[model samples]
Target: MKQLFILFLFTSLFTSAQTLETIFIDNFEDGNAYNWESEIGWEVINDNGNYVFQGTGHRWAVSPTQRNSNIVITGKFKIITNVFHLNLLENSGRYFFGIHEGGVYFNNDETQIEDVQKEISLNEWHDFEVFTRNDSLAFSIDNENIISYKNNTGTNINAKLAFECLDDAQIQIDDLIIKREQIVYNQDAKWVKTGGPLGGIGYDVRVDPNDANIIYVTDNWAGIHKSYDGGRTWLQKINGIYSRTGSTNDAIPMFCLTIDPNNSNIIWAGTFGMRGVYRSTYKAELWEFRGNGIPNVENLTFRSFTIEPGNSDVVYLGCEWTLFEDEVPEGANGASRGKIYKTIYGGLNWIEVLDADALVRTIIVDPNNTNIVYAATGIFDRDHIAGSGVFKSTDGGENWIQINNGIKNLTVGDIEMHPSNSNILLAATGRLIGFSREPDSENGEILRTENGGETWNEVPVTFPSPDADDWTLFTYLEWDESDSNIVYCGASDRGFYKSTDGGRSFQPTTYNAPFINAGHIISIATHKEKPNWVIANSYGGGVFVSENGTFSWSDASRGYTG
Candidate 1:
């Protein structure tokens, strides 16, 4: 079924002013339909030096494209036989014109609106144009207005243009020109949860680099949800995903997800239930176990995951083991218990590269230099005997060294590399949980390193301190791709914070943004092209969206039951 209704999210560039821009043009002169969704029975053919689209046989329809604003479509159309219809379709209603032997008739869906007895010859091309602006529409043929109507319904824009032939009618279309007018909408548009995986904690959100409409979100207990329509709806893709208990019926607790930059279809996922790592070559439709080389997969829970930008096959996996009360293994003190695995052959096999006493929380590979890698460690379990800080591996995880000279808090939850600079980086310190009792369990601070971890400094954050012994960990950190100075920090208990001065200072948003207050923010996502859009996933509150950056937020968890 065609999705007629969709949430049209316009960029901020179009919200302030009106501008006319040519959006689409298809002459079929390039011998390709480009974005036109031509049906099976439709084919581009050349007739006397003119290239045009024609219906080969049987009932067929072709949709050129769709727009979210007012559009003016001009094209040439010719009918070979039978009946044909030109449709401007939307969820609210449909404005279509039917050309039959009787006459040219206009209808708002099934209800006929107008009819004219003008004869249109078969196999004779005629200039046709469709203009839809505000609540008025006009259809012109041969530069003469044939049907003019004012739509009472509030569906003047956001419609798709399609050509259909009925009763084996043959048709030919060519020289299509589509133009869209920038729409000025209300700035008070609020976010609403479309529909997707719910009931479990959404840990990671990834948008396809090649196509923004395709989205992937990992849930702690829902395996993975794939959205092909910009997240309006989702489907659970867990064909080969399962929990550690070997129950395929139950959704696996997916902790992390990463898509190969070179190939969006190749996906890598990590589990929190000792399931190791899994890979999907065909997007997230299916999964296969790819944790062959790592030792003791049943005891470790995986979280941090990253792929080298230089080489997609070169990947890193971070795993950690939980330590219970007084259940630490003998001789485990001062010894690394958590493991970091490296796979150069795309997860076909893995090798234990580094083992740390602290849980490996995050891994970052330098885009400028893939050989240089950084792994941030922190422990959430009972034992905090080993030092938890950032580790640097300059030779592609072959060897490792600690680089926590100036960082006061070592439990780094997330690290973000500057988009245009490699040395400039930011890390968010997290808190420790479990049975172990520590006087200062609350750790919520932003640390910056401009010299590639050689020296680190703290970025002052003004968030109110949590109660004594209560943990308030900074769970994630993300920088606006369009502006590196705009950084966002997500906390486990302190809500959200933003920094506009390149991490020099941070301001808390919970005081004014009540929708995200006290919510355990697990992940923050930002688009490089869309700086005004921000999405933050709360552990229990579901999702929150900020249209004008992180200034204000609204609850976007309508479909989410979690």
Candidate 2:
């Protein structure tokens, strides 16, 4: 009886295995691929006597073999220069598995399915496999599963295989094999949540005015987070924050976190998307929608926020009016410019103080005088180039005037005042690649002003030679409190610069550990008491610390979970 039962089980297994069959296979040993349709940058090439398909530039090659469902694709790929993609074309849509500079991703149509931040070694061969079962697709690299996603947009049909590479990418593929596999669907299977890797686009970090242990950070998408233990651990503080409905995101895009200089409990936050400003009166533990009189909150993008040094009720908000074809204001005067808004009653009422043609990105209130204020104007992308300079107001946000005299580029990003000298100031010109492209004339200029924006002169800083038509910008400036002459500036493309003779001249920092030498530093903070202890933030490299001054750096982004 036992032998008979075992024979029945063996028959059942054989019946299931018989459904899988090979559909198409290619080794390219003969150095010919007549069945593949090639584009301009794709060709069959011999590598060390092993023939393979090589693709360069933004081009693709299609295979003659086609399958609808329950298909398996196995191949070996190597990126010689940049990145590549394997595309599955369907009648209604397409799916792609691509390797990018930062990592790998899977996308259907234009929507992302999964993204993994990994640096794949270049010029090394790696095995990949993709399996499709109904609305589900499973992908693996080197026998290790990377991502498995289920698409609810119906089953992809009339599938054809294609190999492609992105701009300036040189990729090679070999040992292509296709099979028709019998895939049994597991109806009870569901996706489980696993925590993703830490670190993201950290826009701003602020320390508590009274206590050094309290810290707050704003993410581009994760709203606001706070740490009471000096960034060793953080807890999400997005209590009243709300993202747009049906956007598949629960976190709001928060930027420009400002803590009141006199009141540590009062903090203000500006947002990136249409969401308006929020005020946190309880030290960032809870928030409230405080933007009441700001016009067009649904189409406004706030870039900077500042509070009066002495008065907690007075604040400023820098914003850009996002242009919408169907929702343009009745009388926009043919331009969607940026505006500056001021509120004296702590965000209860706001009035537009200045209307400029460029995005108002940074607003600074004079620390010594409450009546003096400065607004810096520029944008990431826009059509008009007007109002790309700095503005000064002496009547406490009542009136403003342009102050771009002797400035090389009017596209100023950030303006800073000297700690003890109000007459001494620094302005960093920035780049914004918008609808109307601006010229990449120079690698961003750091302008020094001795007469408080009356006139400016370039800071004679040495920078790396730029690529042809490369646009760069400096995004931040930091001053060492212990030594006012020691200054630091951050750039979008050239990293960090230090100046010992105040802001007269500058030199780049040594590209030491934890720094990728590619620059892209955005924000830097210097301790007032411990001048040697500093923190710098990079675009994709996370955070770095320099305890013994800015000579050496180490990673300080271990606890970040953005």
Cα lDDT tens digits for candidate 2, 1-562: 5335433432443233335555556665434454478888887787996778889899989986655577778999988887777888987778888885567888888998789877677888989888776566667777766666666766543477898888989999888877776645555786643223445666677777567667777766566777776665666676444433226655567767878888889888888766557777779765656665775456677877888888888889998776666544443323356799888877766888988877787888888887889888774334433646899999998888888998866667788889998878898876654333445633468899998789988888766554522555667788776689898887765556789998899887753544344235656666566667666655555556677767787665555544
Count: clashes, candidate 1: 2
Task: Assess each prediction's global lDDT (C-alpha) against the native.
Answer: 0.71, 0.71
RMSD per candidate (Å) reads 15.2, 21.7
**299-342: candidate 1 lDDT, tens digit per residue:** 57787778899688888998777665365655443222467888
Find the 10 residues in a row with the least total lDDT in model 2.
9-18
> Which ranges of candidate 1 are over 4 A from the true structure?
1-199, 244-249, 324-326, 329-336, 379-383, 432-436, 464-472, 511-518, 557-562
Over all chains combined, what TM-score does candidate 1 have?
Answer: 0.60
Estimate the overall C-alpha local distance difference test score of candidate 2: 0.71
